[model samples]
Target: MTWLITGGAGYIGAHVVRAMTGAGERTVVYDDLSTGDAGRVPREVPLVVGSVLDGGRLARAIAAHQVTGVVHLAAKKQVGESVGRPLHYYHENVEGLRVLLEAVTAAPVTAFVFSSSAAVYGMPDVDVVTEETPCRPLSPYGETKLAGEWLVRAAGRAAGLATASLRYFNVAGAATPALADTGVSNLVPMVFHRLTEGTAPRVFGDDYPTADGTCVRDYIHVVDLAEAHVTVARALRSTPGLDLTLNVGRGEGVSVREMIDRINAVTGYDHPPTIAPRRPGDPARVVASADRIATELGWRAAHDVQDMITSAWEGWVRLHPAAARA
Candidate 1:
């Protein structure tokens, strides 16, 4: 019942490893440390340093660990960066998954859980997006994730492997400050970085049709999202040949301006946000239904927006002591 968690040293991936291991599951972390901190991986767990693009390494690790399942979390995941470098994203994300799948199918592994994203439903016009929603990814990063889902499902079907793709919404917060996300790629961290620099957090736009006239999204705590991975991993093992694709979110929409206000309140910063032009591919609203995951796995998000802001702010301050509360 050993599981291989690719990208297990990164923020989200590290949390997944911790949750899995803490629950008594035998887990091994496979990460290249491209953006991951090796120290994040617990000493008790084995951390394999290698890229997902390397099939030979993947095969060797699979065999050496007698890995029976895989939770593929390794991928380049920045929308703006992906737009600027599509080829790089394709090679590292899509091509890398292809190579990993080839090795996994060839090995004795029977279960797989892919870390997908809400980005797959690019600019989804729906109020609450479900797994059945049409996928029209806007950015190269989102496209790669959508393609990864297709590859995982098809590969599992042909290989007779159980698979689940958890399409995560906006992920934030941490179980602890050390496990918090370091990248400013997402909204929460982006805001945190600006505030820490004593600069006004810029709201992309405020003319959207939402109540607050700002882009609204479903923000999930990284802890809850990580727990969903464990649930999906175990579910895949129990349900043979399962092809599960569920949204991992709280099913509640939070506006960008509202989030900024929350950040100001939580971090003890009263700075106001400045309005700016909307970024291309920005959806007005993209909240997850979250019904399927709850029904299928009996899981739900226990943290709220305040929890996300405060916990994430704690981590930000830990990394940047200059951002201490006033």
Candidate 2:
């Protein structure tokens, strides 16, 4: 199937494009290059410069590429920013998704794989969050994802389009150094940044009801997450009118303090993380069940936390050469 990967120039999107192409699938990248780098896109894949908000461009690109399937990943994902600018998030994420759906449903695209997030379960009051967990998003970012899922599922039901919404857990690591995440929004890079700066990584609120008194979360390697997208994309292509919502994770939880310790060990640093007051709305634990996806697709994460940290550190040193000697 000829697939159109929106936001394919970004970190996770680039990984998805690589994995899909490596699996022998044809792909075309559509990105606005806001936070995505065109250099990250493989030379073989055609990169279309456009926005999901542009219906005309989207329709033209779909027609020109003969795109039979789509993997939409372009969106504003910062929770703090979303809280401050909810309107912009809704417009970029939800409205953009709506416009893309309109184009896809009108075109010959039969399958769609949406990039959802665990944020939809905002501070879930559970040990392991399942797909069936009640969604009560705390931030505008999470609300946008949940709304996007609703839009995708509803559009699929109405238009007979096979669709899958893969709710991703915390994504880290990289398939290669060139494809490593450049943003410092996530915990892995956040810690790496602090260590590189010769400062203690801040551990928010180590007073939670847990073994380490810190928040526990599930971290999935970006490579594994990309593979999950390929898996779901193929499944949607094969099954007509199939609608699925599954959590992509390792089914394990690691405390914030434990993760910081692991980061120190992998990066050859002995600096301990400093404890700070817990941020409001921080969940105590938010791991995935991972049973439904495994049962349905026979896909399980192969990389462990160490593998995640080791590969991520390699990429970190690639960007920050001094990080290795420091």
Error of 2 at 186 (Å): 0.6
- Candidate 2 residue pairs in clash (backbone atoms < 3 Å): none
lDDT of 1 by residue, 1-326 (tens): 99999999999999999899988899999999999999999999998999999999999999999999999999998787888899999999999999999999999999999999999998877889999999998888999999999999999999999999999999999999999889987889998989888899999999999998999999999999999998899899998999999999999999999999988888888889999998766778999999999998999999998898889988988999989876
Query: Pairing residues by index, what is the TM-score of model 2?
Result: 0.97
lDDT of 2 by residue, 92-128 (tens): 9999999999999999999999999998998887888
C-alpha local distance difference test of each model: 0.92, 0.93
Q: In model 2, which runs have C-alpha deviations exceeding 4 angstroms?
A: none
